[model samples]
Target: MQILEIFGIAVALSIDAMVVALCWGAVQPTIKASHILKFSLVFAAFQALMPTLGWFAGGALYSLISAWDHWVAFLLLFFVAVSMIREAFEKGDDNEECECRSMGSDIAWGKLSMLAVATSLDALAVGFSFAMVKTPIAMPAIVIGVVCAILTALSMLAARVLSEKAARHSKKLSLLGAAVLLLIGLRILFEHGVFA
Candidate 1:
């Protein structure tokens, strides 16, 4: 039962990453197998690390801001989502020809870590919640990390294949990704009484 509960939460959490991966694939249709592998590893490492970090932080900091963590998570997710929306609408054809291969291969560790940390900020709050619920720490964190890694890689691959066959659909894909982020952000806000 606990495993199932954790799995459900992990899936819910990974929806954002999976959607982002799809958009990444759509924007850069020339993604390679190596790119998939590299991104999956990067995403997985971060997803896995975030909850554990959050759990530790929770132990040390939850008492300091117990009432505000949810609001903070909501704000962080909203900010990130808003950024995605803004980027989606940006008119920078300068990057249309940019190859995913070069970028993936040359990904600086610092940037990768930054992206990982940025995307996984909500997981930190989720980790804090895990402490509140008294859930065992290690298993859920591992599950969420592994599941996100696999889902993100699969989404990227599917997006690449679809984009190759239907190049014109890239805009639609971006819109869909934006919608996912918006929904996730709104959901977070709603949970936090921001909408109430």
Candidate 2:
């Protein structure tokens, strides 16, 4: 895959992390630099790691599925896209109020780890898709991690100013990410001559 395409995938995969970071930023009574660093590092690490794991798993299965790898990749991306769209429409969590009330200034390592893993699940699938399409995982993984870290950090830092607006329009942002993944999936199909 081209660099631009990899970058697109990276951005698409970072949406969940970005949204969660924004929420945390908005709700926390005080956010230290340490918190931001810790959150960004954890998110980035998971986002990068999951895809690498997926790539390895996909590699193991590649020979058996080689004949129809393109289809598998497209389907995986489609599933992820659909899931994101579904999540976008789900009602806001009632627990958010409680979270905001309870969240203090310090970082919670356990919760951060869980959030990181949760957000990176989509990236794992993307890595599998990359393996199906025979794309190199190194650049994509690095780009994905870096982009996620930057976006997460920015979202957290900007929450003070944009939190309310971001919260209101988060669904739109999610839909946009899903659209990007859908388009990327279609492009993969086209490249494989599936659309020819």
Candidate 3:
């Protein structure tokens, strides 16, 4: 594939990660640089690795991967979103100073890992496409990884800015973020014809 085509695909694949990062930013009352960098690196690793895996697996396992990847993503995202929303309404949440359900604004490995996998699912499919086309995977994978990392970080930064401005409105913003995540999950399901 041409460089531009590869770049386009990379951007398309990275949208999920970017959105997820934004969700984190919206839900997090405080933005930590360490968390952002760690999240970005983990996401980048997943994005880069999936395509390579798919490329190597080639067409052999494409169908199996494709059949369930979207559902997996939808499930993970939906679960997290619901958890965020539920936590928002939990008892003893009236303490505005409390970073309740905040996950310490630290890196929660479980959710973060799940987010990385969920966001990188599309890139796995893309890797399969690259394999089918016999296109070189190294360059494309690198581009996809780098682009995803950068976009996710940028999105998080934007969210941090918004977070700073809306610190007092963290509850409202968290609810909004959770709602958006739920929508994103449903969108993934709908896109995969899960409820069709």
Candidate 4:
């Protein structure tokens, strides 16, 4: 529940949002500040909301599983890290293929919402982990939301700023992000004294 720990978790949880926003940035004919703002807001909202929802759900089950809360937290993070790594290696769709290049992608509310939901699923699990560990959800949720928003915006800007470089390194970045998550998960286990 330390601030640094929460921040680490937030960063780990935001990787998906960042990648998605990066794709959006690349596909648009021209990137704008407003577009970045919109993507960040939508992605951040879902990332924040999912955790709060998970926290509530986890709260209901806390007393029933208090003894193994740390284990659950560690497991949740490990699973999320694994999932991210898996996705990074998965086959790319045409949209995914052109992630760091300009392509005509229609931006709509439904698509944005779906993307938001898809990217925030890990945050939902993270929220559950927070609840299990008795971590206060408010501060952590805020950190996650803010970090996700910033990362999403940055990814978009970075994509546009260095489209060619991004195109070449996007997968490597994703892999690095997943590795960070894996480390964060291990850190959580260590911090909880679960592996000591």
Candidate 5:
């Protein structure tokens, strides 16, 4: 594949990660630099790793993985969305001061890992496609990882700016983020023909 084609595919695959990062930024009480760096690294790693696995696994595991990948992604995203929604409602004090501490307490590593996997499932399938076409995986995987990292970081930063600007409406923003996540999950299901 040409470099442009690979970059196009990388951008397409990174959409989920970008959206998820935005949601995470929107719902967080405060977004620290560590959170952004951690999220970008983890997401980029998964985005790179999944495609490589898919390419290696190839047709041998295609049937099995394709059968339920969408469902798994949907479930993981749904869980995060529900958590965001619950957190939005659970906050009793709108005017409460936020400590702006590390996000470790707010977002557990397990959840972050799940989100990473959830967002990268499509990239896994893309890897399988590349294998089928005999396309080189190295360049594409690197492009996908780099693009996803850049886009996710940008999305988080954009959300942080918006969140700060509308600090008084944090609850509404959280709910909106949760709703967007739910829609993304549903869209994934629909794309997989789960609803058909």
Candidate 6:
């Protein structure tokens, strides 16, 4: 894939991480630099690693599923996007304290690892696609990981900066997140000939 295309795909895959980080930023008293770095590292590392793993696994199964690869991609992305949109719409109390360590659990490393893996599931599937398409997974995976790291950190920063004025606009942010997801879902469907 071309660089721009890879970047686009990376962005699409990173949206979930970005949104979660935004939520984390909003709930925290003050977003710390360390928090951003932690999220970026966990997210980026997982994003990078999952695709290579998927590529290897997918390499084995690619022959059996070559024709359905695009469809699988479309389904995975579409579902992920839709779920994000749905989560964004759910009303919730924002009174919970935000710790840089864990979302709702103790065990910092374990929680962080789980969060990273949870957020990077899409990349796992994309890795599978790389195998199916014979795309060089290393470059694209690196690109995805780096971009997600930057974007997640930036999003946390942005949400922290905006939290003061953004208190009233939380729902709007969620809606915007949802819209981005829907658009990505549509793009995937269109790309896969779901509309044709």
Question: Which candidate leads in lDDT?
Answer: 2
lDDT of 4 by residue, 35-113 (tens): 8888899988998899999999999999999988878877887788788777766735323444433324556777788
**In model 2, where is the ten-residue run with the lowest total lDDT?**
93-102
The C-alpha lDDT values of all candidates are: 0.62, 0.85, 0.68, 0.78, 0.70, 0.70
TM-score of 1: 0.59
What lDDT tens digits, residue by residue, belong to model 5 across residues 114-170?
A: 889987875676676556445678988999899889988887888766534444455
Model 2: how far residue 171 lies from native, Å: 0.7
CA error at residue 95 for candidate 2, angstroms: 15
Q: For every model shown, what is its TM-score relative to the native structure?
A: 0.59, 0.93, 0.60, 0.85, 0.59, 0.69
**Model 4 steric clash pairs:** none
Evaluate model 3: give its lDDT. Answer: 0.68
lDDT of 2 by residue, 40-127 (tens): 8999999999999999999999999999999999999999999889988883742322134344566579878987998899988989
For model 6, residues 101-138, the per-residue Cα lDDT tens digits are: 44632226677788889888867766876675577888
Model 6, residue pairs in steric clash: none
The lDDT, on a scale of 0 to 1, for candidate 4 is: 0.78
Instruction: For residues 79-177, write the lDDT of model 1, one tens digit per residue.
Output: 545554555456244234323344443456677667667767757766765553345679988898898889878877887565343334333444554
RMSD of each: 5.9, 2.3, 8.6, 3.0, 8.4, 4.4
Better of 4 and 5 by TM-score: 4
Show where candidate 6 strays beyond 4 Å: 67-107, 163-196
